[model samples]
Target: MAKARSAIVSSGPVGFLPVSITFFMAILMLLPIGSGASNIIMPHLVMISIFYWLSSRPLLMPYGACAVLGLCIDLWLNVPLGLNMLLLLLTRLFVLNQLKHYKGRNRAVHWGVFAVMSCGLYLISWILFSAIHSEFWPIKPVLMQWLVTAFSYAPVAFLLGRLRRWAW
Candidate 1:
């Protein structure tokens, strides 16, 4: 009985894993690729991390924590304050609502859903940026961002999955 209890406790969620991983990924997203490519091509690593954790361990990553991580990203990227916060919060809510359907689904299903969510995220971001700047920004960058983010999801999910298994 004691051994079983220990096993259960060991497999339980760790509070720091979500926050630290999100923050680390957010910081990584801010790093330059050194390829001299435009910033638009940079993948939103933080969003990928958020989605992974929220899907796998929702309780470990609360909405408030998501907001905080968003704020950090916004500040780090020098974007308008609260922009990332709102988006991250919305993403978290969306994933939480859809998580039940995802429970027994295959990885391909998760990737498809993530692609859809990434599209919505880019669209909303473009709209918000246009609204803030009072001018329609070029759509090309947003499209590039969406593409890069979508393609990068597989590797990010794989790494995060490993981490999740290790943590649990």
Candidate 2:
């Protein structure tokens, strides 16, 4: 009988490209784009990176890396610890589960999946924030962030695709 493949065994060896690119995206996201209020609409560059790499190159962007990146984001954003960790982890899981269905599909279909995933994740963030504060947080900002992030995915993916190609 063929030996069953475990998670670590199935994934290819980790490398510098994925880690560096993801962290670069994270730093870009953490930068001050504008005034404090404007930051609310800042696209989630790091999340987009995570989603792209997880889908396009799952072996390179493992769950442990996702967790670490999320923790770093949580620290940078000053939100409750583990919030981003949870988000990124969920993104990893969701993308991996749906990989076979969407792999090699049309770009538009990938974008649609990303849109839906971002919407759900943002909604969960809003709900979690409200629960933490014991009140409903204004969801307009959350919605705006989601809109920006969803719209930004295509270009970000394009750039990362180039980087991925270059690295190999």
- Candidate number of the best TM-score: 1
Q: Across residues 22-123, which tens digit of lDDT does each residue of candidate 1 receive?
A: 888888888777665643466888889889888876777788899898998888889999999988998899998899988768888888889999899889
Model 2: residues >4 Å from true position, as ranges?
1-14, 36-40
Model 2 scores worst on lDDT over the 10 consecutive residues at 1-10
- Candidate 2 Cα lDDT to native: 0.85
Question: Per-candidate TM vs. native?
Answer: 0.89, 0.88
The true-versus-predicted C-alpha distance at residue 164 of model 1, in Å, is 1.5
